[model samples]
Target chain A: MVNRLIEPTSGRILIDGRDISKDDPIALRRRIGYVIQQTGLFPHQRIGENVAVVTRLLGWSRKRQRERTDELLTLVGLDPARYRDRYPSQLSGGERQRVGVARALAADPPVMLMDEPFGAVDPIVRERLQNEFLRLQEQLAKTILFVTHDIDEAIKMGDLVAVMQQGGELAQFGPPDEILARPATDFVARFVGADRGLKRLSLSRVGDLELQTAVTAHPGDDAEEARRRTLADPFRYLLLTDDDHRPIGWVDQDDIPRSGVLTEALAIPMSPLVSRRTTLKDALSMMLAADVVAGIVVDRTGRVLGLVTVESIAAAMRPPDRGVGAATDGSGPDAARRLAAELAARDDQELGRTEATRA
Target chain B: MEAFIGVFAWFADPANWQGPNGIPTRLLEHVVMSGVAIGIALLVAFPVGLYIGHTGRGAFLAVSLANIGRAVPSYAVLVIVFPLSIAVNRETGLFDIAFVGTLLAMILLAIPPIVTNTFAGMRGVDPDLVEAGRGMGMRGGQILSRIELPVALPVILAGMRTAAVQVVATATLGAVIGGGGLGRYIVQGIARFDYQRLVAGALMVALLAIATELFFSWLQRRAVSPGLSGRSVRAYENVAQLGRVDVPAV
Candidate 1:
C-alpha cells in the first residue's frame, strides 16, 4: 500500500504525514527504497546499473549515477570496482543480497521497505548481512519498514517492532525487549515463543555487558608465573595473546607446565571470536557451539578486548544479582531500564508501520 | 539419387552463373523478398505482441490468434492470395500478384511466432522483478522498456528466431504462385525436367534456410544478458517451449 502495490480498502498510510494513497504511486515509490526476499535483481542488468536503477530512472547524469553506484556499493561492503560490471548471476547468494541492498540504497530514499531482504541466504550469511545492515543503518538511519516472518529477525531488526497477527491487525507494538518481556496478548506471547526471555538476550549487544578480564600470558612468558596468574583468576583458562595483543587461543591451567617458558603450543584451542557489536544471544550460542564456557571479545583488529563468559551473559539476562561480581557493570538491570525508556520514547512516534509480505 | 550426382556439375557451369535467371539473381531475389516480408511482419507483430505481453490483457485472444495462424499452412495462404493479387495487379497495375501474394503469405507465416514469443518472453520475466521495478518508482512504460524488455529479450528473440526461420523456409512457396525468388529455380527446374537445376535449386533453398537458422540462433545468443547467463539454459528451455515452431520444413 505504501508503494501502491496494493491499495488499502480503507485507511490511509502516511509515511511523513503525506497520505500514500493520495500521492502519485510512481513518484512515491521512487522516494522509497524496496527490497524483497529473492533480491529481485534484473537478471539482464549489470550490478552497477542494478544499483543505479532508480538514479537512471530519475534521469541522473551518467557520471552522477556512476558515482552514486560506487558509493552505495562501497557502503554495502562490496568493492564497487570489481563488482560494478559483474552480472547478478556471477555473484553468490550473499553477494547478490548485498547488491540488492546497495541498489535499494542507491537513490538514498528516506524510507526503505525490506521484505525479508536476507531471507534467502543461509543462517551464517544472514547473520553477517544482518549485522552489516545494522551497521549501515547506524550510519544512514533510514526510516526502514522491515518485514519478516521470523520473530528473531523481527526482534533484532526493528527499533519499534510491530507484531502483526495473522489477520494483519497490529497485535503488539513496542520495542523488541518490551514485546519479549511483556506480550500484550496470548497470541503475541505464543508468537514470541516460550523462550521469550532467552530471545531478549538478542536485544542486548555484547557491548552492553561488562566483560570479565581473562588472565593473559605471552608465548615466551614463564609458565610457572602464567600458571600462577591463570590459577588466580576465576576463569582458570589462560587467554593466549601474541605480542601485538591479538588473541590466539586458550591455555587450560592443567596443560601449563610448572617451570618452562610458555610457547604457542601450550594453548589447547581457540574459542569463537566475537566483536563488541555481536548480540549477547549470538555470543552465548558461539560459546555453546565451541563447547567452551567463554567467548573471546575482540576489537575490529582482532585484538583481545576481554572475555564474555556464560555466567556474565546469564547475569546480563536477568536483573543483575548482587551476588555475581562479574556483572559489576550492571548490564542486566540497566539494559532492562534502557530498553523500557527506548520503548516509551518510540510509543510517542506515530508511524503506521509496515505491510506484511505474507503471500 | 542418380540425379544428385549432377549437382556438382551444375555448380561448375559458367552458364548457370551469368544470366538473368542465374544463381546470384535468384539468391538476391530470395534474400530481398524474405527480408521485406520479415521486416513488415516485425513492424506489425512487435507492437501487438509487446502490448498484449506487457499489459497482460487479451492473452487468450492472442494465444488463440497465434494457434490459428500456426494451424493454417503458409502454402495454403500463398495459394489463396494468388488470385486476389492477380485481380489487384490487373486493376491497379501497381503490383505483381504473384510477388504480392507470396510476400503476404510470408508475412502471415512470420507473425505468429514473433507474437506468441513476444508475449511469452514478456510473461516469462519474473513478476518479482517487475514488482521491484515498479517499487523503485519506474512507471509502467519504464518497467516494460527497461526491466521487462531486457530480461525478456532472450525469449522474445527466441520467438523472432522461430518466426524468421519459418518465414524464410515458407517463402519458398512464392514460386509455386508464379513469384520471383530462389523458389523460381525449383519451379523452373521441375517444369523443364532439368534434374540438375531441380537438385541445385533445392540445395540452395536448404542452404538459405540453414543460414537463416544460424543467424537467428547467433542473434538469440547475443541478446541474452550476462546476468541471466548462469541459468539461461534452464530458463530458455522453459521459454523456448512456448515459442517452439513445429512447422514442417518446406
Candidate 2:
C-alpha cells in the first residue's frame, strides 16, 4: 500500500502551475519565504543587518541588499529611518513582528508560509496587523500558505483555505465561502463550529450581494407626490433626503397629506446605516443592534447606495446541499473504498511503528 | 593613605628599578609567568568545556569535577604537585619544577567557571531559536557553530573574565613555590622585611588585574552584539525613527 502522505495525496499541491512535490525541495524552499510562530530576529544584529541577512546569503549585492531592506521595511509599514539601526531587544513586540515580515519579504520570494506570526500579540495589534497584511497581499498577490488554528482568521485571510486535521492531514481544501457554507465532513463542520452561518458573512463581501436602488425623495417635494412614490413602491417608507443628498429620515405613506410639502410628517430618526465596505458580518451586527430588518448601504459621502434585507442575508447564510456522492462523482463507492483501504493499510504500518517505539 | 603615597613614590624611583639580586627582573618574570598560566588555563578549559557542553553525557561529571578542583585550594594543589615534580626532577633532572607546578595549580583553578558557564550557556540557548535553525536545514555542526556558539558567546566570555581574574589573583601562590613574576618580589620583600618592594609588587598585580578585566569586558561587548557595545547612541537614534507612520487601519 502507498503512504497516504508521501504518495499521491487527496488534493494537488501546486505552486505557479508546478507541483510542489515535483521540484527539488531545496529549490522550492528558496522560492518560498517561511515565517514561523516565533519572530526569528537575530538579537545580536542591527535591524537593517537582520533584515538583509537572508538577502545577503542569497547572493544579492550589498547595494541591492540595502535597497531591498529599505523597500521591505517601508512595505511592512515600518519607517526605515527609525528602525534600521535598532537591535531586536529595543523594539516592541509589534515592531519586531513587522520586522519579521520585512525579513521574510526581503528576497521577494513568490510564495510565503506564515504560521501564526501575529498569534502572540494582543488582539488590537493582531487585528491591525492582519488588516495591514491583507492590504499588502492585495498589492503583492503572493501565493500565501498561512497556517492558523483560528477559523475566523483563516476565512478572512486565505484565498484557498486548506484545513489541516490531526497529524497534519488535509481535511478540506476549497474557497472559504464554499467550505463555510458546505463543509465536507462531520470533522470539518465541528472544526468550523456550530455558528458556521455567522462565520460565512465574514467571507462574503458587499460586492457579492445584490443592492436595492432606493427611491430618493427630497424633503421639499409635494407631500402627495412623495406619497404617490411611496405607495407605488413595495417598500412602505420613502427615503427623505435634503437637496445635498444628506439622508434626513423616512416618509411613511400613512403620515403624508393630500398636498403641501412633506417636512413635519417625515420621521427624522433613521435606522442604523453602514458603509459599503462593511462586511456582511458587520452589516448583520448593525442590523441586530438597531433591531431592524434591513440597513442602508452608504458611500463615503453618506449618500444612500442601496439596502441590505434579511432575505438577502439569509440567502447568503443558507448552505446549498452538496450530497455525499458529490465528491465521489463517477468513481463509484468501490473506487473510494479501495483508496480508503489502501490509506488505512499505510496508516496501520505507521501506527505499528509508533506502538513499537512506545513499547 | 599617606603611607601608600610614600611607598608609591619610593617604588617609582628609577634607582629602585635596579637590584643587587635582580628584583625588577624577578617581578617582570612573575608577571609573565602569571600571564602564561592564565593563557594556558584558557586554552585547556575552553575546548574541554565546549565539548562537555555539546555532549550531554558526562557533562555533570566534568562540571562537578571542575567544582571539586576549584574547592581544593590552589596552594594545596601546588603542594600535592610539588612533591611529584621533585620525584620527576630527581629522575629526569630535566624539568623546570616551579613552572610546571604553578601551571598545574592555575589550570585547576580556572576550569570550574569555564565548564559551569559553558554548560549553562548551552542549556540557556532559546529552544525556539535552535528549532528555527534546524528547520532551515542546518545540521548539528552548523547549528552549534552558527547558532549555539554565537548566542552562547557572551556567557562564555563572562566566564572567561571570571577565570582570568581568579587565575591572576591565584598566581600569587606561585611565589611561594619560588616561581618567577611580581610574586617573587612579594615573597622576597616579606622574607627581608622590605615593605616598599612588597607594596610595589601588590600594586602592579592589582593594576594588571584591573586592566585585564577592562580589556575582556570590551571584547565581550563586541563579540556578543554591536548594539550592546559602547556605540549604542547610533542604534538608539535609529530606533527612535522606526515607526512614525499614521495609525494603521484596524
Tell me the lDDT of candidate 1. 0.84
How much does candidate 1 score in TM-score? Answer: 0.76
Q: Which pairs clash inside model 1?
A: none
Candidate 1, superposed: residue stretches over 4 Å from native: A205-359, B1-5, B231-250
- Lowest-sum lDDT 10-residue window in model 1 chain B: B241-250
Worst 10 residues of 2 chain A by lDDT: A1-10
True contacts kept of each: 0.96, 0.19
TM-score each candidate.
Answer: 0.76, 0.82
Model 1, range B1-250, lDDT digits (tens) per residue? Answer: 5566688888989999977788899898889889999999999999999999988899899889889989998888888778888888899999877788888888988898899989998888899998899889888888888888887787888888888778778777889887777888888889999878887888889999889989988766656664566665445445545765221110
Interface RMSD of 2: 4.9
Docking class of 1: medium
RMSD of each: 9.8, 8.2
A120 Cα displacement, candidate 2 (Å)? 1.5
